[model samples]
Target: MRCQNLVCGLVLLLALGTSTVVQATKPEDTAATRAQGQVLFERTCLFCHGATGQGDGPAGWFLGRYASPRPRNFTAGSFKFRSTPSGDLPTDQDLFRTITKGIPGYMPSFASLSEAARWQIVAYVKSFYPGFRTETPVPLPLVGAPTPQLAESLDRGRALYTSFECHTCHGTEGRGDGPVTQAGELKDASGLQIQAADLTRPSSFKNGASLPDLVRTLLTGLDGTPMPSYAARLSDRETDAWDLAQYLRALSAESVP
Candidate 1:
């Protein structure tokens, strides 16, 4: 039992995406692991992902409309929470992280599960998409360090907000009440009416609200939503996402307290 516990812990450390060290071997998709994963998926994930991972569980029926987040269809392979580029299959780590963190206001964190069990869930989710087996996913480079929350940085962020016409969707004040929302022109991938997130409350951010999270979300965009990846425009502008993250932080403070 002592040795078995240590082996589990070691496997967890090697597979954790947050570790600075490169990941070692992942939990192999052996019959034993696959069996555990399936049981966990049915117990924890079947309400949304269904028996076969089609995002059409019994509970998935109600989440299909305006401003309502729907379950993801795993078989389609069009993941939005990936660290990899748009259209790319998310890495095993990406899926692992999402299962660990969960989406705010939509999916509750599954941190209650042991790390090994979480990895099992990730493996189960990956089983729905064949692309996970064939493609190697690579995350983008972290842009410069979190931009200093200084006046100059905020100012740069403010300027970009306008020049880039972010105001068109985010509004002059970073509220979700922008022209598009007013006109009801914004829709998600499923054609559900959608509103841009109110930047004033970072806690409500779907992807995450940390400075790095903001930067990554800005760079990657939420694939199924109207939010777009600004990676091309911000290319080589090392400070862009950083500064922008600071600006978003300032907006969040407005509603936080």
Candidate 2:
């Protein structure tokens, strides 16, 4: 069974490719590098991050609208994407991954930039808050590859989706038009209106669209959003979480790019 699962997982991982490109070592933090990062930030990031990383650029004013994600208030130090625990700062790699992947409909990917440039930007963005220097945030330990019973897991996941009442928010078709959304009840930490994710379009997932990403999101949940942590009910059983992730993956009409 272990061998079978490993083979299945290997195939899926290969198919997914390195959606979150891996960089094993972090570059040294230095004034020159940060200076370059600042230049990059001003040129490419300032439009959304603002002059001082306040998430109040002119374009952001119109882009985020009055919704839950009206540009991140960097000074506030709250982020939607992270491998760290909720309310904790993201690791350096987490910041780098966000830059590499970008938010689906929101932030544009900076994959075109050299890895060094992206790391520099990560450093500059960290400069917005003092915690980055005083604290070293640790990423959550991720689970192993897909289970050997992926086919069986998918079936359980489909059943769990309904039993868990995920359809109440995400809708039956994985569309965002769920009852709560229709009722105008979904709100974020800021009390701004928020909508459930359209699961059918994995290509546009805000945090991430890959299967592991889905599993992690399920386990950790996005902070400051209408999304709740299933970790309470789901954590006691790891299989339940994986099954749920598989089902979410099956709902997508398009795969993650």
Candidate 3:
């Protein structure tokens, strides 16, 4: 009995020591750790995720061929497959899952890295959205429903839409029949073949077909797919969800004629 107790005690001590070592090795989201991660990220992930984590590095150009969804624009707060609801920031575990499991069409799993390293990457990635990270209050827009002149604005929106290459997937008529459909190939960043949503058929939306909802989705973008939030890339006046909503409504209205 004494010998058996001695063996069990030794095993418990060894387990405790191992756990302590692992806990010590795990990275914390400190300034020093983030600094270290920055160096590592620059060396490894910068080419694809960009130095700014904007998902527009040179590698992103080629990514469209295989990835169905577009790479995430880290500047935007959108993340797909998060346990948290949309618009809310993802938890650390959520970010970890994305980094480890990899999002379809956007990122691949980096199983080679140790757990500590992935946490470090999360800290570094959050650095890209300082405003979002800090949760700064946004400036309120010119409030009120769009004016009757909104129709004219929709025409202008159409011009901007085409210029921005929105028609590539959203059809010329916003019926989801853009040029990519010619090959019958549609995909999101995760290498998943997907059907583009027809904006004209607003009723088809999983989210309610309300104008405000459309605007929020456009400004924030749906997480986990090719759809990107144009907030930073486009002028608020130009890409205002209200204007896009008007244009989309116009497009749908035109289909009736």
Candidate 4:
């Protein structure tokens, strides 16, 4: 009986020792992963996105004012071109797309980075936002040209609108009754409530309505509100902007006639 008890005690001690080793190894592995991500981000993206993803990087200011949108403030966690709804966190793949394709105003394509490096960067970036988890995969429009004709643009644009979760804050029908709408309480970095523009009435436009003007809004994003620039956010070329413009036009048209 004594010998049997001794063998069991040795087995328990071995199990405990193995568990301690595994727990010790995990944190080291995590640190190594983060370090790899830091190296890649510093070497490639820090030029435009800033050393800490502040959107005020060196090239960030030099990009000059244009009709296009700009990079996002990752610290704020407001992504302009995500498939997820506004105010929601973006998926890992969403970050990957923005990183790989590059936004028009702030970032350019990073065709040089390997797929593995891109994934690492995605992991590193997400660390900045607390409680951020990968969002569900949101699909894009299925049956339309990247740049649809004026006639089909609204139909396709609706898909883009839905795919991008514009309805989350903009309302399903663009009425500003979206899930995030809280009775004129959508504020900016400031404590002001961010107002969602009513698309049905052109007269209600605090901003004007020209293709260039709208495209610029999409690119540069309106300051002092939840509207961040989508220039680097969306994947479609000018086509994404073009199709969306058409959709907004159609919405405005409905309000008038």
> What would the per-residue lDDT of candidate 4 be over residues 1-257, giving only the tens digit for each residue?
56755664465345423421111111222556667888898887777668888765777655533312334567777765453444556656557666765653346666467766777777777766665654444523211122434667677777777877777777877777787874655765535355476666644543335443344356556554677656565545436766886787677664321
Number of clashes in model 2?
A: 1
Write one digit per residue (lDDT tens) for candidate 2, span 1-257: 78866776676566434756687456778887788899999999998779889888878877658876777767887777887777788888878988997887888889899898999998888889888889888766444455543679888888888887888889987898889987889998778888899998887788787777887677667888877666666756557877888788888767554
Q: List the residue pairs that clash in candidate 4.
A: 68-219, 68-220, 69-219, 69-220, 103-232, 186-193, 186-194, 187-194
- lDDT score for candidate 4 against the true structure: 0.58
How many steric overlaps are in each model, in order?
A: 0, 1, 13, 8
Candidate 1, residue 116: the lDDT equals 82
lDDT of 1 by residue, 186-231 (tens): 9878787777888877788877776666777888888888888888
> Where in model 3 is the C-alpha error above 4 Å?
1-26, 65-68, 135-257
How does model 2 fare in lDDT?
0.78
Q: Which parts of model 2 have CA positions greater than 4 angstroms off?
A: 1-17, 148-151
- Per-prediction TM-score to the true structure, in the order listed: 0.86, 0.87, 0.45, 0.45
Pick by TM-score: 2 or 4, better one: 2
Best by lDDT: 2
What is the Cα-based TM-score of model 4?
A: 0.45
Residue 37 miss distance in model 2 (angstroms):
1.5
Whole-model lDDT per candidate: 0.77, 0.78, 0.60, 0.58
